[model samples]
Target: MDKIHLTFSQKIIVNVFRQVRIIKGNLVHQKYFFILKHEMQLSEFKYMIHDLGPYSYDLSGDVEYLLQNDILQKYDGQISVGNNILDKVDDIDLEEDEIEKKIAHISSFIQQLFDRTLVSEKNIELAGSILILLWDQEIYVKSEIWEKIKKWKPGFFSLIEFDSVWDILYHKKLISKEVYIPNNYIERLKCLNSGSKNAREYYRLIEKFFRYIFKNELNNFVLKEYWCDGNKKIDFSAENVAKKGIFKKMSKYSSSPINTIPILCKNQDRELFGSDLVESYELLNYEFSNIAFLTIRSFEHDQWILDEMTRFYRENDKKSIKKILFLLQDIDLIDMVEFRLRGIEPSGILKEKLRSVITNRNVVPCS
Candidate 1:
């Protein structure tokens, strides 16, 4: 069997605090308390390994330790626990009862912390639910940032706490009970951790979260329509003709000239530079009357392309050559926004945007 390789992000997580484990036959000895006791210099630990790189592993046993330490607890009976029979020096068969018992205990601990955890909706949308849960909870206090929140919600701490909550909820073994804590607790908890200034950062995080979701949705929308799947282009087209020159001359005889719409879709974290829109311009320049630029941010068309487009529009007044640009901010396509000019221009709200742009066009420009 081939060994599965973790991504660059996974390696950093495995080494975050390393580990101290001793397994004896069926007995497992993951002495988490001992590790924390030896490495409890939280501030030093964070500073020493400040940059954890990209991917991080979920320190499962760490949460177990947190629950055992009583810092957090779960809702009643959400998870089950079992007797610590393996802790003794008895040689025993692996029975279902024993397995369930161990899982119950572990699950109970995990669920308790899961219930008590606080996550920001923003971090959940950005870093993803996984990172949010895997983030070490001690960072807030260890960095002296905890004192910064003047006002807070009941359960969650500062902004970062929301990230932790997101991770936990993301992969919780028991998803049914992973309840979302209301904003009230989030707001109150913000004040308690870091004071007024810290609270503001938390507030901003929440705001950014809404923005991110909206942007993410919009990006997804444009991608769904324009992104290429396999070798087939998103809006693939080809024309058949008897003789190229004769067809061109005879086709010029149509009462209504055929217009193609070239669409280019770019989904990137960085800005969409002017060069990214070149291909779209070329495809639609002559055969098409309009080009649509789709991206999460502004579509910066090259100067030459811009100049050509301006000239084309200036010359083709009757044909109405135009460029339509769709830029989504920190919002997802699920939300509604003004986009009437670019065809039917349905924001994130409906599939109508797809119908409007593709229905009457001779060409479709896609990423």
Candidate 2:
């Protein structure tokens, strides 16, 4: 009789089965185990962003191989590596230094996942989904973390509580407090600095630049050729999620209803006058649409737009004054994003801009 040898991965698969009883042949535990392996720097498998969570084809292949080799055994709604196979691997006398350490950690972590009093599938789904976001979403803010989870899987939002999941992961030291830092500053700066002066290209570049820079600020703030408010079309509109950070501050100081703060974006043309922006203002008639951002490549119209913004604010009452217009130029946007990337809260930059628009004669360049 020849002794059987087990690959490193097969041994891990075996150990994961030994500690945790994955009910009903649920294959997701394989992916969960691999995540532990990846986090511990034990495996190099890549994961795809699946609806349920991160899925790995390579890990699937390993599981299939183990099953075919009879190393993995399944029976009666449970799966495990047979005792005979486990004994065979023991006879091989493989080094257990790292593998045992990882399996022990993994096995311990698995116990934290389920509530022993009752089994809930949603908790399992929440665990995997949260891991995927924490691993790849780069979301640091606590509120945004929950918002993103709800946005990704609204059905589970009822079951997934921030305090509950966060406490478990935080207490376990699996996660650390994080801060937001925007990326591709140089690339975006170049695009804003120099791009097709053509109106269409300018609009596209503006969208790309803003979206890339302030993505962490809020999700889905950019839209193209989007129509809303009585079917009146605008280049785009931004629904700023207030009640947090700078947006919250704006509401408190401005003494305005910041809920549903709609910032409108208008496609640009090299017009001599700021008349084109009037179309942007008109779109604010939509219920709760209060703010507007106009991206201009040519600073030639900066002063002109500034003057026009004042005229509109003055003619309108406080209700309309709260609905302000911001002039977003290349340099100003670069400055805003740069401040955020350099560990400055972007909300401060925005506050200054809105302050300048409200109090000072000059625009703060889109706060």
C-alpha local distance difference test of each model: 0.31, 0.57
TM-score of 2: 0.47
RMSD of each: 19.7, 15.3
Best by lDDT: 2
Q: Model 2 has how many clashing residue pairs? A: 1
Candidate 1 deviant stretches above 4 angstroms: 1-151, 154-156, 173-279, 286-291, 294-315, 320-367
Model 1, 1-367: lDDT tens per residue? 3333332222222222121111111101112221221233222122111121122123334334433533223344221122332242132232345433443355334323323343222322222222222243222111122232212223334546644543454355322211222222233333333333343343334333223323322221211223233422232222322232322332354344433323333333355455444455554554453334332322344344334434433443454323332233223232222222122223333233323332423332332
lDDT of 2 at 271: 55
**Model 2 poorest 10 in a row by lDDT:** 177-186
If scored against the real structure, what TM-score would every candidate get? 0.26, 0.47
Cα RMSD for predicted model 2: 15.3
